[model samples]
Target: MSRFPTTPDLDRLFRPRSVAIAGASTNVDSPGHDYVQAIKNMGFAGPIYPLNRSADEVAGLKAYAALTDAPGEVDLVISCLPAGAVLDLVDQCGKKGVRFLHLFTGRFSETGDDEAADLERQIAASAAAKGVRILGPNGMGLYHPGGGLSFRPDLPVAAGTVAFLSQSGNNAVEVITRGNARGMKFGKVANYGNGLDVTPGEMLRYLADDTETTVIGAYVEGVPDGRGFYEGLAAAAAKKPVIIHKAGRTQAGARSAASHTAALAGTAELWSTVLKQAGAHEARNQEQLLDLMLGADMLPSSGGRNIAIVGGGGGRSVQSADAAEENGFTVVPLPDDVRRRVREKAPGLADWVGNPVDQSILAGSGLSSNGLLELMLESAAYDLAIANVGEDWFFGRPDASDRLKHACNRLAQICETSAKPVAVVLGATETNNREHRAIVDEVRDDFAARGIPVYPSVERAAFALGRLAGG
Candidate 1:
């Protein structure tokens, strides 16, 4: 009964039978030429028509003078021409029966010029009347992981559960780059620069029903239609999680947003209320936004707020407590029975068995490989357990390294057994200690592979866990 398209429109953009580049050129540095090459580089398996009046060929592909002159039917038309020339191209696309139009030209309403705004409205009107779907007038076009359409020339497309939409082109690039570094792949990414025709609401509606996407993340400076945006988000959140980062929090940020996307920043309280009602998580900043999105995309949806912090250092425990409190998570202390078990298993050193349980007491204990892990698993008070092992030297206890690995594996097994979630926090110096760093990296990698989120900072780990708990 959903009114939105259940399937993604990527077939028209990424896997089109035929594509016509209205402003295609031979100059590699030009935007049109660069885009054409980027599509080819991403392994697009479709016929490409270079529509250049002067050039005989573009990047060795034969050039056609017009979309009509192309050898076959065109599913997509990519326009990288001057802003003034784009309207005519849109008209041409309608005549050619093109279903997808990607406009890379910039001088739309985003420039804040009256003339440019009028032109954008005109183009949208024309496209709507002709039943053509337009992407952007000042946007990053599109990225479809399955069909390998990446607007970014530097990075290859990576398929993931998170679908991202940004209002700023540069912010989209930053998110993609940073997300890639953090092992967060994207199913589809689009920048609705001015959002002349295709708005965030439309994108959300499209992605909400996408089977390939499990989470939706967005960066918004403003919304053209607040009610529509809320409706779309509410509908989407009913099915999957939606995390958003609003940029214009301050007066200066508001002005910057206006200039960047011609967005009219609304009252913060209104935005917050709307987002809360829609069940969308509001992120404070870019890093937190990505953190929340990654957690939502990667973690299970059933965990509660009870968190057990297992780390070597007392400072880590304190930091984790502070972060948990800030994020509205309860840091449950180890029960008396659990503390007694840890002491019994680790009698070689002094034990401080409390909430944010310091596992360092077993640092030099000649305990079995499963000593600390056994203590944690026996304690049923904690819904989620976070283990923070400092360095490799601490793993020197009898089978301690194996114990730590076994503990992590067992924690995941416990989660599977109890239907709860467990995450690990690996805190170690990133530089000036290659050997120790390598050991920490290996442990972190192992934990991540088992569906346990790992973080370098205790705060980050706690934050991710809190978000997972819907805090």
Candidate 2:
């Protein structure tokens, strides 16, 4: 038999045949008990064994006193016990022949003390010796739509292409909550806190082969084995886009990370070199990270770095230009031919029809003309095109009801012919009219269906373009 089974190992951990909650509780408020109820509520098909020495039944399921008492082969064991008790539980799991373990306890190696570090090492050795894989010691654990394993009560976990892994539990929850609000869904999320046995390298290697995951994102504090991390990232990045937000670079950030995950904070330059060599895109902040991942997840691959910026306002165009330059992309000026075409097509437009290709004149005329947009796209001067359509274009003109649809269709045709990526930025105030917001939503959906990403801000759109161009 293969040491690592040819069959996918995650099925047992994520969609187990039988699950045993080692620290099962009757209180609905407890994390341990709430998760058990979440599994049942989300319609897990497998039998659930809630293990508690004091209880006979838990959350309507038959309770067992220990792993050994649970009937048949228990594929997954979710231990919500204290850190001190985790070792004994592992011993029990080994004897019981449990294959996968999900630990939710903190204050282990992440504490950065000798005792905690030794305890973590021992647990790793024990699990490896028993041929059992561990998820986390200080992790929030795993989430699978099919298995309904979510510690977060607010967000409804759903299966999608994106799979995320993070070292910070709060960051994991924040990403899930925020992404859900923005219409971004996930297939799986693992908060690999402290990373006792399983490192980001191992997780990336595993996720690379997972058919359920298409786009991978990570919030990494530090990598223990730089070579292994780089190798694993290279392999995974070759298969799919890997967006990483590496924290703990600064001295203060490093100190913060020790408290967060007991991670050894390294120099920022070293981290940047490793990430660049590994073909991974490093994000500067949380918002940029999300935008980069969403863009990579949603947009098709492209070959060129040339970009065209279109906007109804000159100010938005300038903002796009600044962002593009800041993110390592060259903002090319429109060629003479392209400029002449734009001027002829929209005579009402401004005379400064260069790289930005402003359509303010046409938009201001209340004509709803996408002529300038089409002219720039057809010029083939750019590998990607970004259009910033203000709320005025959508709600200002009485005859501009179909302006968004017309622009979207034109952009789609341009993308098809050029085989280049296209994105849009629809800027509207949070307190904008419902009708104007509806137009922005419609445009976003339409562009998404065509495999183009839409952003609410020009900076975000430019950042996404930069990532793709960098890759």
Candidate 1: the clashing residue pairs are 333-355
> In model 2, where do residues sit more than 4 Å from their true spots?
1-11, 146-148, 330-354, 364-371, 392-419, 428-452
| Model 1, position 343: C-alpha lDDT score | 65
Choose the strongest candidate by lDDT.
2
On residues 1-471, what C-alpha lDDT tens digit does candidate 1 reach at each position?
Answer: 333435335446545776778899888888778777777777777888888999999977899988888878889888889989977888888888989888888877877789998988899998998878887778877776666676766764656767899998888889888776555777788887877777788678767777878889999999887766776788788889898898897899899888888888887888888888888888879978877776776667635676766655666667768887787677776677776765666654325556665555444566422345446556677666666655443556566556656665655555445444555566655667565566666666665545455566767767766766842
Candidate 1, which segments miss by more than 4 Å at Cα?
Answer: 1-15, 336-344, 347-352, 367-379, 392-419, 427-452
lDDT of 2 by residue, 274-337 (tens): 8898888998789878888877876666567777777657776677888878877767787776
lDDT of 2 at 251: 92
Question: C-alpha displacement of 298 in model 2, angstroms?
Answer: 0.7
Per-model TM-score, in order, reads 0.87, 0.86
